[model samples]
Target chain A: MSGLVVERATPLCQLQDAGRFGVRHLGVTQGGALDWVAMGWANWLLGNPLGAPVVEVALGGLRLVCQRDACLALAGADLQARLDDQPLAPWRHFAVRRGQVLDFIGPRLGARTYLAAPGGFLAPAVLGSCATVVREGLGGLAGGGRPLQAGDTLDWRGAAPVAREMPAALRPDLAAPARLDLVVGAQIGGFDSRSLFDAFNADWTLDTRGDRMGVRLQGPVLDYRGEGLVSEGIPPGAVQVPPDGQPFVLLNDRQTIGGYPRLGALTLLAQARLAQCVPGERLRLRARDADSAQREHRRYLERWRQV
Target chain B: MNPRIEVVAMDALMLRLFDRIEEDNLPWLLAARQRIVEAFGAALLDLVPSYTTLMLHYDVTRLDLAEARRRLAAALDGLRVPEDDGGARHTLPVWYDPRVGPELTRLAERGGLEPADVIRLHSERDYRVFALGFAPGFAFMGLVDPRLAAPRLDTPRQRVAAGSVGIAERQTAAYPLVSPGGWNLIGRTPARLFDRQRDGYSLLRPGDRVRFEAIDHATFLRLGGDDTPLAPTGRAAA
Candidate 1:
């Protein structure tokens, strides 16, 4: 197989696509790239479908050696990526010669990076997706939910297109403190007025103990005056307020169902932005209506339809 | 009764079908899920059926939230109660003993009954699979015999072996995979509740009816049950 070989990688590095869908009823989580916007752009640069399988590299420490000359795209989280000693900025496609090494040292801006090959690195789809969910032990290279490891070969079949660069204006600014748009619903009325006020007004810090399943937010102790709830299906980006008062945003790999009362779920773009946030990053939540958030998400997807 | 629709996100809407968890509500919820799935076609990303609600996650690129709600409401109007009686029926074999079931004696003592009474109470009636969650293949079956009802342990055990039958309050379930849990374990089952290679990936789903058949230790081993003694974890639960 003429492709790249993983020389070294952290457990965080895994193959991801759009996600596993239509199977939530089986208690299966939708696992995919946390920063789906970046994953889309990476595949877009390579002329692949927006949801083509791409490598989601978090907190760097991944190294690959090219076995043959090939072209690939990199997007999201600068991560201080380099090609055989040469610094490579993200949001563009680049070429690699045989025997050259691609190294991701560490995060410079965002916490996650996406790397896409021509037709997405070849991997058998498990549960209709190649997205890895380590908790469920499903999807990924070898179709066993394991992350990329040393000596593993990654091959793609599609022909490489010409090089392209994402417009600077379209790139997300990782430096800014993200203002996540929370579509308030669920048990919002159950929360006390004071806690609700503090929730939107005060800045929340991203807790260090965050993962693909969920991210804990430390800020105001949200008081839930509502009655206890029976377990129910949890949507992606659902901000659940446990008894502790601190809120946690459930992500793609979250449990299919939960009983905790939710303040609301983050808008699509806000979730993609939250995926790039590093621990201790200060952020604020802004309330948004469902219709407006829907329109904004449609507009974001429209970018791919245009040109 | 028509369910009240609540917008939970940009691409999601939760239909509140009932206020309490009861066997009577499952058919309507399952029927509603089927209707919405058919109504949305490719636009429906996922429809999750839980105890009292069906959460519909749609593709925003195809249909906006307002249109989704409108279409969902129309589809659910005068919904026909499914002719199929309470989904699929399954009979699982369980070995009720203190060897694999650490809480078997404790639960029996709490209920003022013998271990045999606890087993009989659990396996006597059919339970409804209300939902699947907490873990892959973990079917949340419910309505454990009120006499055998037990509370979840104050501290959850770090690992509950796969196929362990457990009870928490009125709900009862089997641990599909080895995972941390707080339920009162009463026995072990040989059946695999979840298999990725299986057609549905999960043996039980929402609306399905399940009955537990008490089995002997020798029968459990014959049915592929793991016999390696559960090492004493000094845990009060699981």
Candidate 2:
């Protein structure tokens, strides 16, 4: 069987797909690739489904040796990847010979990098997804919520397509400062006008206290006039404002429900972009409506199909 | 009833039935969820029902925001009392031992009652499952008897044992796994609230009713409550 043997692995490396859905009612969170667009593009290079499982490497400290000759695709963060001491850039598919060693040194452009096999890394589906959620202890190569480790073999059966590089025009510009689009929620009215102005116009720095679960924004203190909110279902990208006044954008692995007042939620594309931002990166939030956000997402998905 | 509909994200919308949780609102919310599932079918990704809100997660690739909103509004218009009244009622066996819950005495003192009386007040009422959240299969059930409505610990415990029953104000919940929590621990249950091997995984769900039944330590052990400490740091009582 065509496979790759893990040589050196980091705790951040885990198998991911679109995500575990329809299970949030059971208190299960949706865990998947933080940079979903990159994951999809990686699989697309191999002619696999957009949501196929792939290895999500964060900050890059993983190394693998090819056990068989196979074609694989790498997308998302330019993790300074190298194959047998030769420099390898992301957003392209390539072939690896048996015994060749692939190393992911560290991130250069973005935080998370996605590596895709032809048919996606083999993993048993748990709760309708192979999205690894360590907190929940579900979905991983071992059929349990564990990150990839040395000695673990990753095998995929799908046939590899002709090697190709992602078009330069199509590649997402990760170098630019991100302006995340947020669709103002009903609670937006409850925020003071000054706070609301600061929320959108102010430059917010990504706090060091960030993880897959949430990214805190350190900026102007948002004065919320609303009384204590009843705990409600918190969707991915919801910008929840805690008592401290700092807003945290909840991510894929966030808890299903929370009591923090929310200004709004980020657009899906913005969330994908936010995942690439490192700690202390300066970002601004742009308020958008539901219709435009939907259109933007549809356009993004359409581009994937066209590719 | 017109719900306050707002965009949760690009592909999800939150429908608020009421400002506060009410028994009557649950039926309509449950009915609305069923109608949405029936109407949207594959387009609907997930439905997260919480206190007074039902968030509908949909696939933007399959349906546009306008269409989804329209379908959701239509579904709400057709909402009626569910024939089954949500899910089944569950009777969970709980061990109300002070040895298992260290905070039981303190919680009882705050409520101006003995630990045994506090346990009695807790187990007597059939609490409605308001939501399942904070952790996997961690069911948040409600309206604890006023006498047993103790506040959460001032400082949260580093690790709460799995199946530990806790109360915070009006809400009571059983911890599905060993996790950090602030709720005042009162008892423990041997029941596996969350099991990955099980088909449904979560033993309790939203809209389900739960009644706690007092059990002896012997019965708790027989029901698979091992005496082994659950804390990873070995802080749990032996």
Q: For residues B5-69, what per-residue lDDT tens digits would candidate 2 score against the true structure?
A: 88877788898888887766677777777888898999988899988989889988789988998
Q: Model 2 - which docking category?
A: high
Error of 1 at A134 (Å): 0.6
What DockQ class does candidate 1 belong to?
high
Which digits, one per residue and each the tens of the lDDT, describe model 2 over residues A1-307? 6489999898889999999998999999999999999998999888888889999999899999999888999999999999998988999888899999999999899899999998788899999899888888889987678989998899885865645567889999999999999988878888999999999999999999988899899999999998888888897799999888999999999999999989999988999999999888999999998888888788888887676
Clashing pairs in 1: none
What i-RMS does each candidate reach, in Å? 0.9, 1.0
lDDT by candidate, in order shown: 0.90, 0.87
Model number 2 iRMSD: 1.0
Clashes of each: 0, 0
Query: To one decimal place, how large is model 1's interface RMSD in Å?
Result: 0.9
